[model samples]
Target: NFILFKTISSCLFFFFFFRSYGGKILVFPFDGSHWVNMEVLLQALHSRGHNITVVRNSKSWYIKENSTYYNIITVPVERGIDQEFITNTTSGIMEFERGALPLTSFLHLTVTIFHIMIEVHKIFIDFVLAMLNDPDFLKMLKYSNFDLVLTDPSWGGGAIFAKYLNLPLVYNVRWILAKEAHFSLAPSPVSHIPITGTGYTDKMTFLQRVKNMMFYLLAQIHYYLMITQTYQQLCEKTLGPNIDFNELSLSADLWLMRVDFVFEYPRPTMPNFVYMGGFQCTPAKPLPQHLEDFVQSSGEHGVILMSMGTFVSALPADMTNEIAAAFAKLPQKVIWRHKGDRPANLGNNTLLVDWMPQNDLLGHPKMKLFVAHGGTNGLQEALYHGIPVVGIPLFFDQYDNLMRLKERGGAQILTLSTVDKENNFLKAVEEVLNEPSYRMNMQRLSRLHRDQPMKPLDNALFWMEFVMRHKGAAHLRTESYRMPWYSYYSVDVGLFLFGVFLLVVTTVFILMRCLYRTVCKPKVKQE
Candidate 1:
């Protein structure tokens, strides 16, 4: 067995050895979540003998000044996720498809609204900004051309940028969202699919199941209309009237889903979708002696880490107070990331700070659990380290993500709706800390998640070269690629008519034979 295993491993290594991942690459990671991951990828690619460039707008996450980056351009920000009026509007879901519109999910509703409105508002803002950037963009284009435009799926504006620049785009999703499954424009493989009527066991009611389907259709319809209207104007303003909107939407291609398949629920997906996990890792910098010592002393008793990330940091004080009290009660040491002075009457066991090295904390041997806001990046980091989670979902895809983690028995969720309640926060932390299942499940998943023979970054870089080598071959397409659900499954009005025809024919034949024997004079002979 040992000899056989060695032989197989050696053969596989040689097979992959011939593939070229070492090539010139440029990545445009517009969001903060994309920053570290892209950096990790560039470094990986660099080690593989590839040249890489990372460009950004002023809003881009902090990038080191003089690095191996072939070229780094910091463009001016015409717009950003933050806007004056946007910050005030406390909703994310906009009504279009009732199913797509979240009903029971307050968190999903809020976060969806943020994504929709910001991009909708930014369409015009980015266009005008791009025009202002035409001179600079054109000048940069002259110096170098990118083989692949790696982008965060959230940056719908980046899609436009890719289109304008005439570059092939590959997407990296920071969040685990169902939208990518249905949205044809995403260019990645559809990761999640409906379980019911489609054939799976779910406890949701028939009406509820239908509503879920409706939600998907609604979301697609909403984006379709929005993108159409927005793109039409963009064409008129930028490309003039000759180009058809439909063609542009279809022609927009290339996708790389950054999610690790092992971590998400079982679902149908396509080949265009690839994983780029572990894209977020910080460069080696020595930690402060105090920080290192803090990590060392916090032994088997376990330490809990908490953070809500930046955008939603402006949380209600009541929620903040509830969290503090909960932290004070835990047997474990708690390090909570927040802003402003520590509230009076804090406990020695609880440490409050304006910032914390979340990834680093998760990596510590003493780290017991992570209390996160359920943002995709935080969730990914938690999963990467195999640390159990206590989710306090705020908005957007947070609820769904937390739900997934909860269902998997990998985490505990404490809704923001009840966070201000002392009992609620305290109970949640206690449940997470005491529950051995969450940790066991987390470890199980972490093993499976990391079981990959090759890491996601290496896999993506390899496949990317495969794309260039194959000259954009359809080999990357999955079995799902060949069939649209309706056509492939033969579930349609046409199939219904065919079944009706067969039924009618069988019924008529039986009736005609009966009548012939009873009334057509052949009955006497038969008797």
Candidate 2:
């Protein structure tokens, strides 16, 4: 067994080795969640001799500025308005006065989509035009012919660049492709596949399925009716109208979606849609001395690590105080990532820091529970470490994410709005900490996640390099992308079947009437 294992490992290594002959790869990562995962993959590819150049707007803050293997080119665009609006809205989810929109409301969802599309379209068009307007930058890109263009599908600029430069384009998604991307590339029937922001699962009730279908149709109809023409015009103005940005995007050579069966529900995905959900996660390193000592000193009671991710670092004062008070009563020590002053009445057992190494803390054996805002990045880390979660979901798929974890039996959720309730927060923490089943379930999942044949980084790197070597992996492109909407959904098939049924019923009714007129009328007259 040992000799056979060694032989197989050697062959796999050499396979990727020969395929590792590098190429110049261009990456366009915009969103924060995307940046975290894409950076890891980019670094891995860089180590494999690939030259990476990242093109991004000023709104992004997480891009590594000083890197030996990769280069960064910042595109100048008007940032303050859209960037400020997005930041404020995202932060407002946990703030009481801001009155964040509820995820369950269709109006809220519609408005959110409309707002995002308007802002994103503006940003995309402005960035492209600004870059095109710069002679030096345009000359630089024209001279440096990149081999592959990797992009987050949220931004259409990547598709524009690939089309203009005639480069092989690959999409890297930080979230599951259940949105518009799936509509084109995969089967997203509302019967089973849950909507991205909605909290429904694959085993949805009949009415829940209907609601899911409504959300899907509304989004699709809204896109085609409101945004399509304007987006086409933007493309025509910036890049030539000759190339359809939608078509160019749908023609992507490969798609790397941030999803895995361990974290997501089992669903059918296309051949090219590779799942590398936890690619950003790595084996936790030793914590800083102070943090390590804090956890060690917690004794048998263990520790709880709380963080709300980058965008939502601070909660409202009232909620913060409530959290502080709750932690004060608990025996377990809490290490919270807080930026400003400590909450009033903070307990001796709790410690606050400007930033905590979340993954490292979660990996600690004494870590008991994760109090989080339920962002994908944080959730994946918790799952990787096999720690049960106490989720306080605020907005934007956080609720849905936590609900899924709850279904998996490893998490318990509480809405941020209820933080002020007496003992609610404390009880949630206590229940998860005291329950053995949650811990057992999480450990089982952790084993499944870790016991994969290959690490996520390797899987991502292999697929990325494979696309580069195969010149886009054109054979992997499913016919789904090219199929028309009606055809793809089998809408035509349904209509055809309905038509045949209607025709047969009508013929039978006509024959019955004819028989009545031909024989029944004569019989009645004779009688």
Candidate 3:
């Protein structure tokens, strides 16, 4: 009886201990694909008894008005990045990729992308104004007394809101305001660290490095013109003229980066930047009955899974026909997530579903290869499942994500322009499937990724709780962002030392010349 009483007491103690540590978190999330990952984090937090309130636009693409895990504070807006905008932008990029003139296509793509970015940021700014201008909403937020603001830093509204609330800020981050989070928070040397969209790796030739530097410069220009100036105006109008949006972006107490070295190339990172790559990945659950039957039917030949992620619902008709025709040539059964008109060339071995269980399908024993658009979440899931990939990157960071895996010998990349021509899709798929090295290398990566001391999700949770408990992690944050460019690089000190060296050399030379004239002139006169 005494022993039973002790066990009960211990159980109660632990239960209360966890219950007391539950925090109130205010989440500002980016919609679309980013929300998919953020929702994973939110669910975990919800299971841990944390109170999560998500701030979303009324017309958000993926985020709904209702959720079991979190409360929603929807900001009504006339404009938001909806499906139509994404579809149009993606279609334009596709057209540009297929254009005959390379230089002209490149220029058009750049201009179109920049214009889209400007429009998106303008919408984000409008959302921020709507929120700030609402007195009742502001009062409700202020009184909530949240422990920390957890946000994806892709958009600046969250960071701005956190500052306005005077709450501790934490980031569930991969991308920041205008670039990758690492470039904003770490020492990103262009010589080795390739900028996004460059299609180069850490090991670069001289010309590649030159191109990398140029891209880095272009990113900086984009940040200054599109992000800094635009957001700075909002900051001044809302918070104060003294507030710096760039510095605010870097001021997160903890950065839960969505990548680890197993997937990302080795590079310098900040103390507060914690990598939790593949945190959203979990062991596969049993597939749906029909899906299970389909997998079982594949027999010894195995299966290939294809998804273009959340953004690209379907490809152009001709391209889809090319892909479908190529799939017809393969022995393996194909399960494709396609949301468009049925392709006439689609084979008997292929099944078209509006959606498939991507992670579960990847983890299945019959799964042989993945045909993906190279989204980070999808690639990470593939890595977790030890599956080789044939990457057909469409836009944004997709190509870069694939390039990382290709560099590691676990994946093959095919450009959109080349994928439809000369049986490239079939060739690339066949190469990955037949190549022993592709699967072996990917399995090796899987081992390395799984060999972590702690699971990525647990690590992320611990740091988040650490921030909540401590109020903030200011000590781990660097003041380098506050430094002027000359001071940060020590250029001023180098110039000062150079000037001192010149002065000393000139003084010594002058003394030696005088000594020679004074001593030698008298001797010559005596002679």
Model 2: per-residue Cα lDDT at residue 150: 90
Q: Candidate 2: where is the Cα deviation over 4 Å?
A: 1-20, 80-86, 96-106, 175-184, 493-527
Q: For model 1, what is the C-alpha lDDT against the true structure?
A: 0.61
TM-score of each: 0.76, 0.88, 0.96
Worst ten in a row by lDDT for model 2: 174-183
The candidate, 1 or 3, that scores higher on TM-score is 3
**To one decimal, what is the Cα RMSD in angstroms of model 3 from the true structure?**
1.9
Candidate 3's residue-wise lDDT over 67-121, tens digit each?
9999999999999999999988898789778864767866777777888888899
- Give a tens-digit lDDT track for model 1, residues 1-527: 99999999999897677534455565656444446566666766677666777666654435654686446766665555443334344323222212242345534653456466546445444643664457867667546755655655443444555566666655555431224432453332222344211221234566656766765666655555655555556655655576544344333244556566555555555556666655563322444676666556666677888887755444565556667776777677878787645665567777777777778878777788898877777777777777888887655566667666677788877765556654877787778778888888887876777777776776777776766555453555444334456854468867898999999999999999988877978757778
- Estimate every model's Cα lDDT from 0 to 1: 0.61, 0.78, 0.92
Candidate 2, residue 275: the lDDT equals: 78
lDDT comparison, 1 vs 3, better candidate: 3
